[model samples]
Target: MSPMTRRTYSFLRTSRFLRPHIIALNKPPFAIPAYQIRAMSSGNPTSKMLTANPLKQIFSQESRPAMGVWQMLPGANISRILARSGADWVMVDCEHGNINDAAMHEAVPAIAALGVSPIVRIPDLQPWMVKRALDSGAHGILAPLIRTVEDVKNLVTAAKFPPEGKRGFGSPIAMQNFNPMPTFTEYLQQANGSLLTMVQIETQEALNSVEEIALLVDVIFIGPFDLGNNIGHPIIEGKMDPELDEAIERILRAAVTAGKKCGIFCTDGEQAKQYADKGFHMISVATDYTLLGAAMADSLTIARGQGKQDKPVSY
Candidate 1:
């Protein structure tokens, strides 16, 4: 048998559940049982071999929306702290945050090692950016400012592997986060289905094609601030425009109709909870920089003998 086939056989042979099925069917190792494939593809929380992506596991197992935090700062130590703080996922914000390619590489494994799925928010829908984020061992890539169905298609093509997409692969460090990491062959076989492909609906053009775009990606994420600005209803003086609210609802409805997950960016727990209650699948509760500033400000206010008061700005 070829080395790749041999590796597959060896991996299957080690699985007590699969060994009997393989022998009974007299099938090639590549022909995994339908149930096993489902377990792997859907990230069965009970399946040891297929639980590499914590975000996927949470999506499969939990009824509540996956709560996430945005990482604007650029340290593996900071990433680790966020990962351990009860978040289901941590977004390494490469788009607008201080995180660059090198910092992304540093953050992914650190976050993943703590069992939190590290999602990288790339600056744009560029193929090279997708490759870099995925190759760094991220559980997902969130591309910002996607404006067309073709853009969604290109994003999917750049994120997936052969037959499904044209993404090229050769990352030696990609599987380092998984406990008892799978073989390279196993990682390659599962990465496409296991990793998330999220695209942002931030532009007016994107809002127009939201339904079609929703059908293409794993998650349809809303950038509330950008969406408002692009649609000529910019959130002014901390107030949400009714027209922006309508656009956000339209995007949510489109995602629901497409049977796809919808996500949104929120400034605080209260805002995140409101979106979660509206059936958003994923919600970013806060950003590192903003949270830090807010906390400091609150502490100072208390120190100065002023009782806690709500911050008016929403974005």
Candidate 2:
């Protein structure tokens, strides 16, 4: 027999327990029967199966900052690849990506399976959008283009279920995405506090209402490009525009004063590090499209006899 065939046989023999749960494509990955899962896990009802929100723990404690990448693609395969690559979280960009509700349902579980938080950036602050994303087991929601305290307040309400807010829940696959899956009752109880509600501080109105907005949401996420554009500076490559710098610092201060976490969009690891140094709790280091494009461009340059490649700037 071939050596590779022998190795495959050995692995299969050793992995007998996984055989029953293994599923084919064109079906939900967690389609393992409930009885089988119960048999595999302990029979104790008090013993929960998953934690449901790992990012909640990370954010609650003020230890090391969280790092994440933005995913603008639609497939579960792309999300799975990035999740396994060691990012603390993955922001699935439904706002700008061609992703729809169906695609998000596929991607969330794939990212969560790798123990990484899957935060969906909803296109807008619509209640239905928040409900769909949350029902799909998103650890959090990132709302873009937030301009007023009312916007953040409305988003928080849409994200939480009463008596805190008014979000209706009805997803069968919800708790499965968490690590130590909770009971149905526990999910309703813990979800409101655990799930993050982040709103963008980009436009002038948002910056002006920064203090009030900070107090209303779990996180104040800065959209640097929009903020720069609103301020009429428009962020430039490697150039430190004083006006833009002041605006960022103002938002950061507002969040800190309100005792809320802060997040920002960063283009690369180096920029992410700088933001972290400024005490931002979460930083998006890169995006899948940006990384892919840069790699493809580099390869093409080398093929054309170019010695080195220049860094990419996303504006």
Candidate 3:
């Protein structure tokens, strides 16, 4: 076997239970039945381009080039705002921020209308939660704190359907964008095909097992802040320590070896650039709350600079 390429699951290092599931793609009752269907975009009159689905289209090319912003506002509006801002994608921050399933119920659809993919960062690997987000019409899924091959396996099962994984089957509901009245099979092929899945490898354990984990995922969106915090450098935003830097390098290299795209979430332009140069193609530059806070701070500074403010500069 080659050094970097280990025939991809060549050795039976995984447990028997997992080995069965690992081969889910090739196994019975786990394969997604492929069907040739006419491609359909969301029925937005303004969107004339041909897209199978908004979310799946992002991964059409191997690069999956995108720049997203997380958490733009307090309510569901952030998704739409980020879309309007021309972001290719945006992740509703349920893992760290206060985005519950109910919140996603309201936010995801709104974001979709704005012509950008809305990915959800779920709190855990609960299949129901992942299924809930997908059922609720999520364009993509961003699972946080992925640490092992087991984690990847669970996510795969949760996110995909049979012959691939064990995602439940339901074609029409308020969840699948309520295609008014569509058959179950019709919804399955369209929605599942358009689904995009991504995972974060931020924790020390995840960083260590990232090579194997990367093999199980399509994209690697590194969480810099939480990763640094996990490594004892909390709140040292935009600062790079050698150990952390090396860890980040290892992650990127692993993604390359695993044939996956690498992405980083940072709240600064400089740090974004640093990771970009390090081979991160898809990245999120800031959060919803952070953008507002920074703009507020800028306003305050400018106001304070005005020596004699007769009244607040309101325009």
Cα-based lDDT for every prediction: 0.83, 0.80, 0.66
Clashing pairs in 1: none
* Top-lDDT candidate index: 1
**lDDT, candidate 2, 1-315, per-residue tens:** 468766754554456653322222122322334443334312232333324566766876448889999999889999999998889899999999889989999999999999999999999989999999998989899999998788888898898866567887546467768877654444555677677789988899988889889998888898888888887888776565888899899989998999888899999988898889889898998999988988898999999999558886554
Could you tally the backbone clashes for each prediction?
Answer: 0, 6, 7
lDDT tens digits by residue: candidate 1, 233-284: 9888779889999999999999889988899999989989889989999999
Better of 1 and 3 by lDDT: 1
Off by over 4 Å in 3: 1-58, 62-64, 171-184, 190-193, 232-237, 306-315
**What's the lDDT of the predicted structure labeled candidate 2?**
0.80
Residue 220 displacement (Å), model 1: 0.2
Q: With candidate 3 superimposed using the best TM-score fit, by how many Å does residue 58's alpha carbon deviate from the native?
A: 4.2
Worst 10 residues of 3 by lDDT: 41-50
Relative to the unseen true structure, what is the C-alpha lDDT of residue 8 in candidate 2, on a scale of 0 to 100?
58
At residue 253, what lDDT does model 2 achieve? 92
